[model samples]
Target: MSRAIRSAPSAAAPTFAALALAAGAVVAVLLGVYGSVHQPTGRTLTTLGFSSLISMKVWLAVVAGMLALAQAATAAWMYGLVGGSKSAPRFVGPLHRATGALAVLVTLPVAFSCLWSLGFQSYDTRVVVHSVVGCLLYGALVTKVLVLHGRPTPGWLLPAAGGAVLTALVLVVMTSAVWYLGTQGVPTSTGY
Candidate 1:
């Protein structure tokens, strides 16, 4: 067990860590600013055969959010923060990385559609919350990825980043997807 753990590669180079941190911060800030200021066009692009694009986005976000939840759980297990397991199975690391990648992949289209079509809105309380949370969600993701790649990172940084990512995703789901479903009724086409 110890040998397996020891076999994992050491932290990344200091130069890489610095670059990741700076680049990640800049990207996050740009996203936040862009989301905040871009005027909503009040139009959306739909997936093929979907009655409404919003419904499709909702479902996609939910799936990504659920995957993110799995990533968080696996992370907790890896850190011995949950499941009472002293050592995480080898599969846990791969699962975490795979799920994380999938979550990000699924979210990309939704984010692009939102940013291109909606461009942030706040006509109502829910709209405001949703728009803000959406921006934060991407920001958190960038930070999490940067920290994950950074060498000599603090022990607490990874977990904290993961927690932030999970929180942001949950908030995005609640404010947008869940709220839309509760208020607008789930579409029969998607059966969600």
Candidate 2:
């Protein structure tokens, strides 16, 4: 029905944005940590900035970061829907949708790159955990309508907003942890 279609986009935006934000936060932080974590020599991170992009760690992080930014746009759109504002219509809506779609487009390359570079190892718990978390976040956004039990909130884009912001926060902390550990010259445990 037209009713269902009308509400779908609005609700979906928040969920997508939240997932992106969370993933982005994680990626950004992890990139930072990659440099901080030191080996016995503590010089392994000197080349982090440029090298990161080419590395498995950095690739995923970048994907997350890019997606996160896109998600922000999406959430903003959702917020407009909930808040009954047309502020997000100008460029936010299209930009959000494009970015979300683009994120998915990039997923294939990232996934392939990860599989090729990291091999079956990156398929370990730590990587899988992150993947599952990211997927859950995405799923939550995409399926929010079904879960809402009939479009409950008008200005309740909070769940989406909160999730996104939290994701960014978590990314900062997690990446910081990784960086701190690396800075300490701990061994790079890929299986984490």
Candidate 3:
């Protein structure tokens, strides 16, 4: 009888996943370290039509958070985790990507303002939590991107990375924008 041959299992997927995770962890650590070491300028770029940098940042963050929610819904639809359809429509993927991109775009200025003006602060519980989560946000984003684009990875990896990103986003928004809006209320006049 002729011998039957079997293919060896490939380790590429696990290896890539590990590398991606390590890269993300490194980025997160570096950001925290840099923020901790760097001196904050106490000044940030101003946006026209906004009362203050803080107001602008808060509003931008809110917008980003909303976009992230949309991204989540679209992602769920694509995975058949939401809606009643067995298969996602062709538009779902594009919509998910667009919303994700928009969310990142909206948060860029806010992140820059926070990192440049405040650095990493730990004077209070809320501030510390916000700072920590802010660093985690970028890390999670990196990991999610890698997992999404990398070679065939375990089915669970993408969702885990996405969940991490979403969690970080929510925490960052709740700690910063929500807190600010609750305590300061909406800015009504310029220079507020």
Candidate 4:
């Protein structure tokens, strides 16, 4: 007679991590709500050497959105999700992280200015899309960070979160910054 070998039971579920993710998501959504309802202060924070703060914001948004695209591309290459080499170089991972961090840094001032000076105004179609994307962008970023730090989430989770962040950032740039630059003209408005 032969006896079957049994594997040990797995450790307890990561309840704390799950809870943290939930809390982060909630906080992000609440922030979006607050931004939406809050009235915009007419005054804007200026960037040194830039014609106006809005111009700086536009330039930063473009750079951040481009970096986000690069992140997505590198991630795809790493995962072999695109038509390219079956594996990405080891440097790709570090590059992705560095680009993402830089993108976040670049966007911080732009986000602060948008929320502080414009709230979530929607006086036109572009503005409406921009407002909605802005809300989603913060939420997506929070979710992406949570998943990045969370314990062993599903394989699809990280890519999905990253994709969402990229999409939202692109939409925000297209609808607001790019549109403003193309139609209304750059540095559309000046100091308070």
Could you say which candidate leads in lDDT? 3
Estimate, for each residue in 93-113, the C-alpha lDDT of model 3 and write its tens digit.
788889898888888888878
| Model 2: lowest-lDDT 10 consecutive positions | 38-47
Could you tell me every candidate's TM-score relative to the true structure?
A: 0.80, 0.40, 0.90, 0.83
Question: Per-model C-alpha lDDT, please?
Answer: 0.72, 0.44, 0.81, 0.73
**Candidate numbers sorted by TM-score from highest down:** 3, 4, 1, 2
Better of 1 and 4 by lDDT: 4
Compose the digit string of candidate 1's lDDT tens values, residues 92-170: 8889889999998888878877877777677899777777777777766776677665454544555666777788788
Per-residue error at 75 for model 1, in Å? 1.3
- Report how far residue 22 has shifted in candidate 2, in Å: 22
Q: For residues 53-159, what per-residue lDDT tens digits would candidate 2 score against the true structure?
A: 23434444556556766666466555655346645555665676576566555444443343333332234565544534443343344343333343333334435
Better of 1 and 2 by TM-score: 1
**Candidate 4: where are CA atoms >4 Å away?**
1-21, 188-192
Q: List the residue pairs that clash in candidate 1.
A: 12-151
Model 3 lowest lDDT segment of ten = 1-10
- What candidate 2 gets wrong by more than 4 Å, as runs, is 1-5, 8-60, 81-87, 115-128, 134-192
Question: If the candidates were sorted by their lDDT against the true structure, best first, what order would they fall in?
Answer: 3, 4, 1, 2
Considering summed lDDT, which 10 consecutive residues are worst modelled in model 1? 1-10
Q: Clashes in model 3: which pairs?
A: none
**Which scores greater on TM-score, model 2 or model 4?**
4
Query: Cα lDDT for residue 98, model 3?
Result: 91
Give me candidate 2's TM-score against the actual structure. 0.40
